[model samples]
Target: MDDTPVRVLIVDDQTLMRQGLRKLLEIEPGVTVSGAAASGQEALALLATTTVDVALVDAKMPGMDGVALIRRLAAEHPSVACVILTTFDDDEYIFGGLAAGARGFLLKDTPPDELVTTLRRAAAGETVLGSPAAERVVARLRTDPHGTGLEALSAREREVGDLIAQGAHNREIARRLFITEGTVKNHVTALLRKLGMRDRTQLALFLAKHRDQR
Candidate 1:
């Protein structure tokens, strides 16, 4: 596990939610709330000044939604992980956030401990998702399994892909596979390119549909 405390930035339109999340995170041992933002723009502004390991973003916001902010973060601050924390569990918002490079998808009503754990996992480079969000992704995969081209991936890529589908981060995957994290990252990059997937979320969804076969 990472020894450094995970720095988090809360982004939500509601002041109460932000305050609650901050308070909750501040109490956790290996986590800290670096800052809070009322909107995606404000979140971006904060990112410009403060460096955070993870950003807990709301799905719906007045100006730039979580999906857009996630996309921008992916482009501008690739190191920072984004996690969705919202009340809505709609398929569109969940998948949109994932496609935009969000490492996690969690509901607003999640238990405090689980939220902290998810943030820590995200900070550790894992693709964490709430149970409902995971279920939604699995359902989507069941509906559209044929178009993903999972067969194109090599055997090693398949191994990496399966671990990714299981929500294993690069470090964990590396440890499990007896390979270096850099090698795992290479496999991830190659597999993603081979599958023509946008990110690990899509890769996981594709694998979830075919998990029975594997």
Candidate 2:
């Protein structure tokens, strides 16, 4: 892992929120606030010129909300990881942001230490979710276990899916299964194609829904 400090950008409509987050993160040992934006557009503008390891985005904004911003970032700035921060733990925002390629979802009230830790983990290619956000994801899985498209997966694909549902990334999944990361990526690609899912977030949710059947 890189020992260099994690560069971050903060995007929130509220000036105070942006400032607060910047202050909080700037004090952390391995984190740096690269820039702050008041909206998604501003974030894009900044991202065009600045390179950041992670972006902390507010879930609700007047235009180009966090979810949409995440989608945009995934396409245009694929190198920067995104994390959603919101006051409300709304299901739509959580799932939507994740589906759009956010690496993490967190509440505004999250502890300073945990928030910093999550940012570091996300920068290191881990998916980080707040306790409440994680619970909501599990509840969503439990509510609709039948439509996960699990029947279409091969046995190995099913194994990969199970690890994904448990929140393991490609490298971790490969290590655990004694397969190459390239193999894990291939399985993930197949799983996404067969299941008609957009990204790993949906894959995880889909597999989580059918965990009992495996």
Best model number under lDDT? 2
Model 2 C-alpha RMSD vs. true structure (Å) is: 12.9
The segments of candidate 2 whose C-alpha lies over 4 angstroms from its true place after superposition are: 146-214
lDDT per residue for candidate 1 within 1-214, as digits (tens), equals 5579999999999988888888888889998788999998898899999989999999889878778788889989999999999999876567767867899999888998898889888988999999998987787687656534454457887888889889999999999999999999889866654454567887778777787655
Residue 104 lDDT in model 1?
97
lDDT computed for candidate 1: 0.83
How accurate locally is residue 197 in candidate 1, as Cα lDDT from 0 to 100?
58
Per-model TM-score versus the true fold: 0.68, 0.68
lDDT of 2 by residue, 1-214 (tens): 6779999999999988988888888788989899999999999999989989999999889867788788889999998999999997866677667767899999998999999999999998999999998987787677645534455468998899889999998999999999999999989876765564667897788779878866
Determine which window of 10 residues in candidate 1 has minimal summed lDDT: 144-153
Output the lDDT of residue 175, model 1: 95
